[model samples]
Target: MKKEFSGRVHFVGIGGIGMSALAQHLVHCGYAVSGSDRQVNEQTEKLQKIGVKVHYGHSEQNVKGACLVVRTSAVTPDNCEVAFAQKNNIPVLLREQLLGEIFDAFKQRIAVCGTHGKTTVTAMIHHVLERCGVSHTAFIGGEYNKSNYFFGENIVVAEACEYNRSFLNLHPTICLCLNVEYDHPDCYKNFADVQKAFSALFSQSEKVILPSELQKMCDKAVLFGKNGSVQAKNVHVGRGTTFSLYSDGVFACKCRLKVCGRHNVHNALAVFAVAKLLQLPLLQVSQALAIFCGVDRRWTLHPECKFNVVCDYAHHPTEIAEAVQTALSMCKGRVFCVFQPHTYSRTKAFWQQFVTCFDGAQEVIYLPIFAAREKPQKGVSSFRLAQLARQTGLNAKYFSTFGKTAQHLSKTVKANDTILLIGAGDVNNLTKFL
Candidate 1:
């Protein structure tokens, strides 16, 4: 074991997708890992199965023997375990700090960051690299093929999140930014604040990959959109999308994806750019893109349902708009959206956009806002959002609870009609009831 990780390393919010991946990685690295969460979920169960002690609730007693404590930004300083660690003189590190340390240990590091598509793009890079027989580890923000932590060596691929500017901790050999938009209103003052953080990451990276629209942000970056060095042409969206991949106007390969949406075409193009930089064959990478099953909760389709039910992790207005439009294009019948707005701050920040993002849906049903790490604000509620949509002449309703939402869907959703359970919260839990 490394001297730095000699004792039990503790995680305060280990149930989080990002935190669990790190905790599992430490366990594989032969470190004694322990953690606590407010509730038990898949992640906590996985850790317990691997012999890592997991407490169901937080308490100061949980961090007793820890050499170092790790916590997500959401885990406030006043958290009992965090406060205890600080008072005891045990060093506490933010989740990003530990992730940065692990990233630096690898020879080739690829960090994917954006307001949207970080998880999907990171998973795509991992998928192609694995198919090409590259030995590398990946820390995906969400599960891909039932796991978030892929164990390997030499190279590391990670989803670098911009929330709280946590991604700044990473200094990557290669950094890919899908698109930059104003998000995390709780953390960033405005769009410029968001761009400055991304610009800083691009500045430190040995090689930078960005969409054509973001070219002016980083002079050294290899662009990957329309008119970019890596571009996709003739995009046809059907079962998924089929497009032509080009590098600097030179035809690279004909690509077909199993994942739906034009957003995914952009994501795959980013992967192609990264693979080209690594000197991987375009043909092999193209084949991998075709067979790549998308990450969970990212357009995850359920065949067992009476009607088409797709679950997505799109909480922002931009992402929600894209997801709804993609569903509208693919569905044979009317499309319905059951959206649960994620946080109070985000809902309030993008109030006008959210009101119109569901314009194309046959009927839009919203549940109460999922207040993550914040108390409810006075003016922001799913009810008001529904009222706004109705004012614009769209069919919209707000249900106070998941049970009521599911009950309404059961009565209204018909065969061939597509239902999108959209949000980054516990909306997926409603799937079982449906």
Candidate 2:
């Protein structure tokens, strides 16, 4: 894949954030990019506006005459485009494989991998490098105001996903692991299996960065904390929690973020760890933190109405709890939660955990589970979660509809109430409608 090579490349699942970013990258590099998704949305519209051909539904014609095809794990072998590409001898590559091929051009490839916060952390490192006018390329999961794309290939930051061991495809110079936990039960059978994938990811890096808590899943990885080698200290959890970065042996300067949560401090620290690895000045990393407005929909503030409408992608119980507590701390009033549980298997597996995660909220509104890849389970529904919520002594209500729930939230929440729309799926979009 030369910089001048512009081949007939088509993406099978093109509208997703990751796939669309890849297509956009190819277009920037002069490749003729075409893609097919099951549905049309903003990302497809953005691609079309940028001169990339995109179709609403997948078809064999979409893959025909293409020199190469890019597919995702969600794209099954039976997908018409994938099957057609395979049958016609067209080279088909997965998203991760394509990333590995693209980053081969960079002198220093930095990968951020973790069960959580990889997107924020990767964007953070990219931000610091970009702000200093260091030419770098980045492929993160979210569009954080934190950074932009590369200029002269000084650094290339990529979010290493752990799904199906996808991160393994990329041999990174620097890797991160943010508390690996049991997830993707459909992909991995149990907790040990998830840890094994993470352990393998940790072992491959030239030098790894991890929080002190997950040191058990790893050893000898670069340690970071409020007082670790590459980290922030004196993190006063005032109104919104302020902190400063520390490099090899010097405390750079104090910095504050518009974003909330101790997790974000950890997120920023991961970036600081990589910056130190590259010998970037600690002051540059601290300045980037102040400029970060936060990733889209990751606690994007909505201070328009009486109550602030915070949107986040906290589908997992642990993520939800963290987001809720963060929101609660910021709100002088009460924290109202409008949560849509994601995936049927997740809802069923962690049914009891969801009930208790709302402890930080003043009230809880449960929406139907967003069955991403799983068929809906008969018994495992948001209704069951609402039942459990009641048993936990929280003011809970189950709404099978997002519209009704949003309306309810608008009417019920008092002035200065903080409500977070938490989920991985379309639930966050409701905040926009509000």
- Candidate 1 lDDT, tens digit per residue, 149-230? 9999989999989988888888899999999999999999999999999998898899999998888999898988877878
**lDDT tens per residue, model 2, 97-177:** 888787656678788887778777777777788787788778878766522333345567888887778888777777766
Q: What are the lDDT scores of the predictions, listed in order?
A: 0.91, 0.79
Residue pairs in clash, model 1: none
**Candidate 1 to truth, TM:** 0.98
Spell out the clash pairs found in candidate 2: 136-150
Rate residue 343 of model 2 by lDDT.
Answer: 90
**Ten consecutive residues with minimal summed lDDT in candidate 2?**
145-154
On lDDT, the leading prediction is: 1
Cα-based TM-score, every candidate: 0.98, 0.93
